[model samples]
Target: MPKSNTIPVVLTIAGSDSGGGAGIQADIKAISATGSYAASVITAITSQNTLGVLDILPIPLAHIESQLDAVFQDLNIVAVKIGMLADADIINLVADKLEQYQPKHIVLDTVMVATSGDLLLKETAIGSLKDRLLPLASIITPNLPEAAALTGLAEPKDAEQIEHMVTAMRQLSTSAVLLKGGHLEASDESDDLLITQNETHRLSTERIRTPNTHGTGCTLSSTIASFLAQGEDMLSAVSHAKQYITQAIGHADLLKVGQGRGPVDHFFMLHQ
Candidate 1:
């Protein structure tokens, strides 16, 4: 039997990237890189490369539930990172599991769109996410496009607008919202706005000029969950994760894994 205070375990509930750039692969890599024991429950499988997603095969809800039950029953999961929900049913299933296990920390990556501008989650699933999952999340990370979609905004142009959208999302969900500014058009820097019930924090970093930006959002959320599993507080975890991702992007390996875009090197720390 495992000891009471073994290595912190973190679970990732998301899709599978066949190319291993994003989704469950990226989540697992990020969790392991941050010194956490990684577990996963796959929601879907995609035949994809850095170029684009060609096909998506969603797993049955029963299988996802079984995977979740198996892990939570055996291991002591400290944190959870939720990504793509293939459909409304899957989203509901995940929500049920969260209510049952009640992990100490939960990071919700609102994975609606892909880096290649592909829609990952179904439109009908949004209602379920907003109603069931987001409320239970400790934090919800949404990129610009996804935030706009959730808030029904034409486009979020400035930081003020971003905060407004986040506030709107907060009204719909009980979790703190982190609105990512990477997708916004900017000449100088990238700004990510994190809004909670009590305060707002603005994190700014230089825009990384690279095409190897795949799996960034997934990496960020999972990294934050890993830090949380290590007993870091919420704001501290987010701040550390921001710095981690910034360094990861700056030192991104220039490997042409696929024809179009490529993944960042999660093992950059090992090489450094």
Candidate 2:
């Protein structure tokens, strides 16, 4: 007899993107595509589209805390992917809840700005995020701009600079760092550096040129968490996630979700 498929539950604690291209929406889509159940705790709600973010409404700390409690109390959550928390209060609240429940895998996407250049995290809350939530993460995934913000280093232009910046970021927390290189200019191939205490690994691939690159960050982090929930080791999980995102980006033109930078096709594998 064949073994049964176990559907591991993965939680995403992030903001709601009304456009359905990024944030909690993208996380759920990517997790579902990877054969995991996605449960969400919304930290904020945004009125936005692929073109840009118009407005944001931060969820109350009390309400956010209740939602976290509700999920942790009932679910056997295997991994947690955390995205935009919006404010200091929300960040603090999530940190407290995660400490209490202590989920096995926590992948933190330090979302500071959107693909459309709209600010997602408040300037004041950056400190709180670094001081409190970062240490709790199992791995912290930051795009170039977000990595610069965290490390107080200028945007790295090459692999050597990126490695140096990653070293600085590692000192901030015990969590492993995945410094994304997609935003680097003039790159022959986009590369991501994953630095853990024991070793550093590089995952590189040709850049898929597509306007539909709206939710790549959200999708990548969520997929990584999903793989971890399915019992893959961290290195294997990140490696698989790189392959998944590359495929999604390659097939991004299939989606016509919005007027501007649409969305990566999270279900691209199903069509093939």
Off by over 4 Å in 2: 1-5
What's each prediction's clash count? 0, 0
Question: lDDT for every model?
Answer: 0.87, 0.91
Could you list the CA RMSD of all candidates, in the order they appear? 2.3, 1.5
> Candidate 1 local accuracy as lDDT?
0.87
lDDT of 2 by residue, 1-272 (tens): 99987689999999999999899999999999998999999999999898999999998888888899999999999999999999888888899889999999999999999999999998999999999988999999999899889878898878788877867876878579888999875777989988887788999999887778999999999999999999999999999999999999998887777789998999998867
How well does candidate 1 score on lDDT at residue 144? 81
Tell me the deviation in Å of residue 2 in model 1: 17
Specify the highest-lDDT model's number.
Answer: 2
Supply the TM-score for candidate 1: 0.95
Clashing residue pairs for model 1 = none
- The global Cα lDDT (0 to 1) of model 2 is 0.91
Error of 1 at 261 (Å): 1.2
